[model samples]
Target: MRKMLDLLSLKLLRRIEIRYRLINSFLLVSMLPLVIAGIVAYRESSSASQEKVRIFAAELVKQVAQNMLQQIEKIESSSEELAMSERMQNALAGYYSKNPAERAAGHGEIIRLLLENYGSFEYVNQKYVLDRRHRIMDPQVFAQLGDGVARFAEDAPDMKGRPYWDVYSTAAGQNSVVMLRDILFKSNNRVAGTLFVGLRPLHFSRIFESVNLGYGSRMLVIDARDGHVIVSANAADGNAPESGLVVAVARNVAEGRDNFVSYRDGDNKQQLAAFAPVPHTNWMVVNITPLNALNTEVRSIRNKIIAIGVLCFILALVLSFIIARSISLPLKQLVGVMKATRTGNYLIRMDYEGRDEIAVLSQRFNEMASKVHQHNERLEELVAERTRELEQANHQLEALSATDSLTGIANRRRFDEALGGELRRAVRSQKPLALMMLDVDYFKNYNDRYGHLAGDDCLRAIARVLRTSSRRATDLAARYGGEEFAVIVAESDSANAMQLAENIRNAVAALQIAHEDSPFGCVTCSIGVTAVQVDEDMSTDTLLRLADVALYQAKALGRNRVALSDPAGATG
Candidate 1:
């Protein structure tokens, strides 16, 4: 009874240790790499999102600034045209050269010229001139806006026949975006008068109306000179917090950073901001959007990675427990089989169903024990046969590992090996070699239109074409990666490589795979061809790089065509 209890305790302790070791080994081996990959992917994806937002925001703000410049430039141009006229210049010099009564007497000519020139222009909501006496030439036109217009001219800088823009609202509820310019005399270059022309608020409204900056977004036209906001699209000056947009805009205007991005907008929320300077004016257009709003895709990727890691963790734990129990039980059985074989019961075998190392060891032991004395003469022949079988199995396994299972073509590992070997042989023979890289055009759209299973079939079909096309013994066709295939031709020059590439492109297009998403109404490919006379200086990496460059050129020029690399390592 003591022996039985001791044996039971020993088995229990061994099982516990085995379970602990298995769980620890599996978790460390699997989860550690997964955790590292998750972290790397998350950080890279985050950085990419931030960069994309920065570029997009910079472009959007630049477009807005350009639109605003176009509108303002039109107003400035019209006012300059009116002010540059000989009659208008004479009328201004005559009015400002006289006393208040005489000026008032000749001001009718100024008003008549203003009415005749800009009166018919619908955008000219308000037009007048400010003189030395602060008198309004058209009091009726100025109405409740006279004081505001005069103050603007007083506060504005000295304009020597140039336009200055201001945004204001009068006490009588008249709002105008007015342009101020000085009418200079031809002889003395003195300030004849200040021209005031106003536009409606809706004039600047259309510039910001069409832009969608997303939720919790803000768009402001900031004066670059003084860092004050001229107009806001979705924000109001009085009610706004003035912390987020104001701070970012202040930085943008101060630093002249048109591509500034990724900052806390002072609302305790992360935000992305960009600004662009408006041409012909000292103003900048700023666009600010919440980081979370722009990071939705990044967040989704992160969450999916986290979920996959968690699921893997749980599955690993459960699998560890199951594997531990299975191993422990099988080890006990294997011991029993060994004891029976020691007593000459060689027929006893372990009934294990696994492909692990333990299974292989047990199978070897079973075969050795069963054939120990039964076939002494035939043992040598049997050993020879098993050795041959093992070699054949190894060859099959190696081939499987080097080939892409989905496409039934040589995989990236095999492609790399082939390329290296081919370069060496070419260098020895001083012969030229050609490489072609082919990509299924618009494959992502194709997969989105069809299912992934169909995509796999499509790749297999392409691989069949590659297999048939490269008929030479020295030629190798490989699946470089998803939707990308490569071909290596020995003793080939650039012209032949290009011809082969064209053939491949045409063959792919002729497949007639219905791809509604593709422009050709059928599946097509783009091929990049590069051939170089192998020398001691040539490397596989350089060849692959050249081929990739040519591939990008093919994509740039248009798909469904082939591009060959030039001698200067550019597209031919």
Candidate 2:
């Protein structure tokens, strides 16, 4: 009985030890991989997302700030021009010059100046002058200044000081933007009157509207003198706060440390702010974006890792030892196969048993392999097709480039090339060559009367006549340029070339195209023929010029006529 009990206890202990060892091994094996994968995924995702967010934010801020700087420059230069205006200075001198009649006369001149050039000054809403006494001199003129125009007359206690821009709400129920200047005399350099121009803030906003930052980001121009938001897309939100961020950023910006800063919004959300100062104005621009919105992927990745960890723990407890071994062995094989994909062997695949994620992975690998094979096949086919297409395209391009668009004949460039070769050949073989030049008569008036379509038909008919009249295989026909054509005949004498020219002219005249403006009482062309000789130093340019001169003589003498030039003394 004692021996039997010892054997049974030993067997039970072995079973318990095996279960514990299996559980521990499987847990360590499965959980370690999951943990490593989670850590690597989180790190890679964070790095990529951060890089993308940084570039997007930096570019957005830089472009918006640069555009606002340009607008500030325009406004400053324009204000300088307005301050130096002769009519404006004379008007201010009249307003502050101690006589009511002079002031009235100055007012009339100022009104005429504003009215005469109102269209030119689209940005300036109204112009006004404050007298030395600081009293409201012309209420009618004030009415014309509109409710948005703010005037601090020279007589006020605050008016004893210097020139500055004042932005405030006016009694005229307008948001007034005003520039104040102490007008001076060029001779004595004394203060004349306060020259003020009132502009609406809305004018500045029109320029800002064209700049794009991002979908939810904004470019804000805030007054450094005050916390008022001047021009911004966020102004329409109605819930955006009057920013203390602007004041703090402007102070830092003035000290030359223009770096990005973080702040909280009215909704208590954290945001990133970047700003720059406009050089001549008491205004700074701010670009703002929500920080969380920018780095949203970080939170999403963390949540996913936690969820995966919980799932792995459940799976570790449920799977049996033998089953876990089976899964682990296949997984190791799959990892090796996946590694092969990085080396471009996309044909590698894993063997899997059950219809789970791993099985789906196996199926995906097979599909990917199939697609790669198909893509390789398709790539080869595409390369073949593209090669054939390129050859055909080359042929078509050669034809289109050498031939005329309207007349289906060789064009001037082709003619130049051909003439050079033929001249060389004629010099080598001691053969004669002839050139014929022809022009349309009354083509411009024919176009004006019957339209360009009829004019094109007439040119085409003339080209056809020249083509038919020249019957030799060595003859070449070409469109020289607009309303002009030429032919080169090899081994043809001057007598035969002149006869061919007459034949072309008669063929075109026989076409019966009407030209009421024709000096010959019919639609016709002028022809010039010149023969090239062997001993003569004949070149393409020289032959073309001689033929052109003969063509000119034909037109000058009378239309519907042919003229010929002897080229016996032609030179290179």
Candidate 3:
């Protein structure tokens, strides 16, 4: 295994190119920063989202608690008024009187008072008064108290003048809360009867319904004293099961503090819950929401972030390939060219026309190859005088090839090659380069009036003027096409370029070439000038296009005029 690992390492080190290594390094370093930023952002967003959910749930639970307290307060207030009533005290005071008709009238009067004062409340489902002997007053007014109330009375036999709350399920499987209050006889200041107010869980359910706790969330009112659920709304499809989680949360909240928790239930479902105690009662309002339901938005944001990260990684990979190729391809070509030259092939040359140091090296290499080829030719010929004659003839042939046959000036091919070189030089030196495109005004009319030979002579005269105007070795005057000429000036500003263009225009007009059909009466040329402070992003084609645009503007304004292109307006 050790030998195999060594062999794998050797193979990787031997086969990987500098380009691939650079790309791998760039991707590794770039991905770490991106990953770190993504993790930090995700952690911050998740923490913030969790905190917001907790706050919302706690506030909702508090609101529900407030509403329940209000309802309970109304009931307690009504119960207190009835207990303190003079008629209720007088009735209980005369309950054992020998006059049987007086006892019946007192019970009827108490029932009439209950219906008149407390009947309008929607949450008051049942109301009744119990005497000291556990005999319910007006028994026909309410449903049976059932065996639960009898057991409750036996448990609390003292019947202290205080309110007691209990939750119990009826025979119909509906839950209800019963508020039992002790009634006192005012004269003796002792417990005389009990005022019972039974509330259906449906009334509390309506309170929960008023709040929107999202999907698959529930609200419960729990009896803090007994850990019993008094009211559970939207807990399930039909009847909500009294799960262990619900009981645990209720008991935990009954410790007299508002709190929130996240836990999994017996069914392996994640739950989020917040609880608050209802004021003036031994009850707590709990808002329980499923974790998956609340985390939907969070999950979506996570997925979107992951997608963006993947797209960024892909873009980085593409950029790495582009940057690596830009560096490696030139070196590879140089290696090939050097190998060719080693085999006695001196004609091979690098065509890279960039402002980088590599391009400069390639140009020097080509120059060295030319010198070597010339030296070898001189050594083989042995006659120095004949070699000199042949060299001069070669130079003449080279010059003729670059010149336009009719105009005796540089041709379009030579002009294009020189422009590329000059553009590279300008970038390296950080100097300006200017281009001028000129057209002979009404030259076609001249050809129509004179013969093709006369027209050729006319072009030759115009080319001479352009050539004389561009006197510097760095400047080039070329016949771009029929009746159009181009000039390239290096290390010059816009002002200098405009001056040279005007000089060429004036020189052409000074030729005094007659054109009878022309609008100008004499032959003239329109010039378009464009100058640029060269940079890597600017190309030869871009400069040509800008100069051409200026030429069009000059023609549009009038003939034989010079128009300069705005560099800021030029496109890439």
Ranking by TM-score: 3, 1, 2
Report every candidate's CA lDDT.
0.76, 0.68, 0.77
Please, what are the lDDT tens digits per residue for candidate 1 over residues 314-430?
Answer: 666555555555566668888888887666666777876455555676898878876874765477788999999999999997898788878888998899999999999999998
Listed in order, each prediction's TM-score against the native is 0.42, 0.41, 0.42
Q: Which is the winner by lDDT between candidate 1 and candidate 3? A: 3
Backbone clash pairs for candidate 2 read 134-155, 537-571, 537-572
Best by lDDT: 3
TM-score of 2: 0.41
TM-score of 1: 0.42
Question: Best candidate, TM-score-wise?
Answer: 3
lDDT of 2 by residue, 253-294 (tens): 678764566667767777766666555456666667666655
Native-to-model Cα distance after best TM-score fit, residue 335 in candidate 2, in Å: 8.3
